[model samples]
Target chain A: MIEAEGIVHRYPGFSLSVSRLAVEPGEVLAVVGPSGAGKSTLLRLLGGLEAPQRGRVHRRGPAVYLDQTPYLLERSVLENAAFGLRLKGWPAQEARRRALGWLERVGLSGFADRPARALSGGERVRLALARALAVEPAALLLDEPTANLDPANVARIEALIRAERAAGRAVVLVTHNLFQARRLADRAVFLLEGRVVEAGPAPGFFQRPADPRTRAFLSGEMVW
Target chain B: MNEVLEITLRSLAVSSAATLIAAVFGLPLGLWLGARGAGRLARSLLYAGMGLPPVVVGLFFYFLFSRNGPLGGLGLLYTLPAVAVAESVLAFPLIAGFTMAGAASRAEGVRRLVKSLGGTETQAFLTLLAESRRVVVAALAAGFGAVISEVGAVTIVGGDIRHATRVLTTAVVLETRKGELERAAVLGLLLLGVTLVVSGLLVVFGEREAA
Candidate 1:
């Protein structure tokens, strides 16, 4: 489980405050908001990529974070996927074997030896997914994972997210897609102007938002 | 003719030695500054260092090693070692500056991803270096070019001693002054050739990186 309490992060002209946020095992928590509502910032804080000014972030197991545009190492695809295992002190051969397996899972086995920089946008996203899943992290924080992806890639990614959820990993997804939230999220939190305007089970939140801003956001109206 | 060969070899040896020393110190310094994101102050200092004149560096070391100067008892003045010291001073900043730029480029993304993947500080740094290796090669080529073609610094500190401290650049000056135009031309061509080889390597690396 990963949880944040009373988190307050400030920037030059903006601030994000989250009184409480939690992700339990096997739960898919979709964070939705308009652009600039601090979705990425919130993911960074949860992933330990950034620290909040005043808050306690607690996580019970290892976690991995993936940004919208995955940053692949400038090396062979297999090496990039095996990077986390190497960092964890796994033997090189064993790590490569497991990375190849993950690559196969993501349908990238043919490009194992190819340079990561040569990968196309969609392939790079899949490579990043393989890299993240090879380590089998207990928690995964994905920021705009399917944003700008083609529908085919989007469906593939959503299926992978469901598989991770089924395997009992906590998944926090940040997206602007209401349909995606309805399809994959067990719970949904609507963020408005850096504040959580509403949080509840995905169906109720999408069908009957308690907050006016959430209703407005869901109704195809920009809340900002 | 044999003297030209000797001078060319000595110049190569001296400059190569200087490049090795500069890389030893400069690479780590650059990496440190780069990993820290190289604030404006650091960038300014490095650029200023890059602009330092080779003659001034040579003169600085000349003062340090001259008999009447401090630590003169070491008797390093007018020697190959003294010339190398000046060359290293001239080359260090070029290597370090380029290295800093290369390592810092696209670093934030890699840093964040590495951290999230459980990489230790050292591992993360090594990853950054690996990612920036091509640029580092470019830095080395630039440093090598700066040191190898330098005449002012080696001339001032090396004293152009025949069969001992004489290098290609200083030899060219000597030949030109003594009306040995043919010899000077030869030496000059050799110098240009060396620069071209290094530059060619730089171009190839640049192309590879771009691809």
Candidate 2:
């Protein structure tokens, strides 16, 4: 479970304030917003990458945050995948074994020995996902995990997220793709200018947005 | 010829020792400064240290090890270790500053990734340092280059004592003073050759690691 209450984070000219938010086990909560709407900030807060100035984040078990442009270690792909496991004090052979299993699951078995920098864009994301999932976190916070991926890569990643949800991990997905939210989100929040404009079941939130701003954004009328 | 060989060996030993010592201290300092995003004042101080005059460092050590000086009781004023220590002081800033620049460039992303992967603070720092290994190697090379070719600090501290504290740069100076221009030129070339070989090895190692 992941929960946040009264999250108040501030920068020089911007602030993100959320009174309450929660994601239960086996749930996918999509945070949909335009650019600069604090989606990534909120995700970082929930993932404990950054502490909110005035709020509490309650996360059960471990939570991993995947950045939009994932940072891979300057090492072999196998080592990159095994990084988290190694950090948890797993023996080298055991970590590599578990990492290899994840690599096969992500369809990257053949590229295990290659340097991580040698991987292409989509392949890097898959490797990042493999690294994250290998740790078996209770919550996964993804920030634009598939921003510029091809359709096939998108499908593969979406399938992985679905599998994680089915396996009872809470997922907080921050995305610009409304279609993707509609496809995978059980509950959704529409954020505009750092405030949640509407929150409900994904279907109703997309189909019958409660606010005119939400309708405007949905219709592409709300320009940044 | 035997004297030349001995001088060359001694020079390599002293400079290598100094470079290693500088790296042992400098690399960690650089990594910490880089990880913390060193401020303008810290950067300015580092740059100044890198450009510090070698003779100034030599004088500082000379005074410290001189009789009636603070460490005078040790009687290390004209020893090989004194030369190495002086060279280390001269090389330290170069290694640390280059490492700081390299680590600063890549530390943030690596640190964030490590932290997000449930790593502790120490783990994140170690990961950052590991990721910047290439930079550290290059920094060591720079330190070695600076110390191997340095003459002023070794001369002041080691007193260039023949068959004892004499090294390539100091020997070059001694031969030139005796008007043995050919011998001085040969020693100079040997020093250059040593620097070139060490630097070449480091570059090849870096490239191999990249591959």
Candidate 3:
């Protein structure tokens, strides 16, 4: 379980101020907004990428954070996947053993020994997913995970996210693609600038966004 | 010429010695400054150090170890240790500056992700270095080039003592002063060739990184 209590993060010309936010253990929350809408900022704050100036981000059990930019190591795919687990004091052999399972889970079984630098864009995303999942995080936080991916990879990533939720982990994903969010999100949060103006079940929010910003967002109108 | 060859070989050993010392003390310092996000201040100090006249740097250390000075009793002046001191000074800034830029640019997002994963401070920094190994390797090349090309500091501090401090660059100068420009040119061109060789190696690494 993850709960964000009055989170506030300040950046030049913008800020993210969420009063209260929480996700059920097995829920999937989609954070949707246009560019500069603080979607990534909120994800970073929650993911411990950036510390919030006020309030707190509390998480139970282990968590993994994946950013839009895949920070792949200059090593083989197997090594990249095993980094976090190894840090947690898993022996090299055991870490590699677990990494193989996650890589296979993300459909990258054949790429275990491949250098991470050589992976394609979609393959890189898949590898990033594999790396994050290798820790078996109790919760997963991803920022624009599928933004640069093509349609085929997007479907695969969506499936991967859905599968994680089905396996009973909290998943928080940030995206600008309304269609993608509509497909994968169980609940939706509409962010305008840095504030969440609408939050509800995905279907209801897609059909009837309460705030003007949310409605404008759903209809492809520029609200920021 | 044979005597010069002996000096050359002798100097290569000394320079390698200096480079090893530099690798030990300076590499980790570079990694430290890089991981912590020291901005223009650190850069200015490094660039200023890089641009330091080798003779001036030698003079500074020379004064420190001279007979009446603080470390005079240690008798490190006019020795290979003196040369290594100056060489490391010259190499330190190069090692740190280039390494910092190289590592940070390559691992910008890794720090954030690693911190989020509950990694310790040391683990976060180490993760950046490991993630950007090619960049760190390039930094090592840059450091090597700076230390090896330098003639002024090592020559001055090491006193150009025959069989002790008469390195490639200093010997090249000695040969030139004696009107052996041909030999000087040979050494000069060899120095240039070494630079190119180092550059070629870096380019190979860069290409591999690009891949």
Q: For candidate 3, lDDT tens digit of each residue in A78-167?
A: 988887888888999999999999999988889888889889998998898888888888888988888878899999999999899999
Q: Which ten residues in a row have the lowest lDDT in candidate 2 chain A?
A: A189-198
Candidate 1 regions with alpha-carbon error over 4 angstroms: B196-211
Looking at model 2, residue A159 earns an lDDT score of 96
Candidate 2 regions exceeding 4 Å error are B200-211
Cα lDDT for residue A75, model 1? 83
In terms of docking quality, model 3 is: acceptable
Give the alpha carbon lDDT tens digit for every residue of A1-224 in model 1: 88999999999988899999999999999999999889999998998888789998998887889979988988889998998898889999999999999999888999998999999887899899899888888999998888888998898889889988999999999998889989999999988778998999988999999888888889997636
Q: Could you report the Cα RMSD, in angstroms, for every candidate shown?
A: 2.4, 1.8, 2.9
Residue by residue across A127-204, what tens digits does model 2's lDDT show? 999999999999999998889999999999999999999999999999988899999999999877778888988888
lDDT tens digits, residue span B110-179, model 1: 7887888878778888878778778788888888888988888898898989888988888889899999
Q: Score each candidate by Cα lDDT.
A: 0.87, 0.91, 0.80
Cα error, residue A27 of model 2, in Å, equals 1.9
TM, every model:
0.94, 0.96, 0.91
Positional deviation of B180 in candidate 2, in angstroms?
2.6
Model 3 bad stretches (over 4 Å): B1-5, B181-211
Poorest stretch of ten by lDDT in candidate 3 chain B: B202-211
DockQ of each: 0.55, 0.64, 0.46
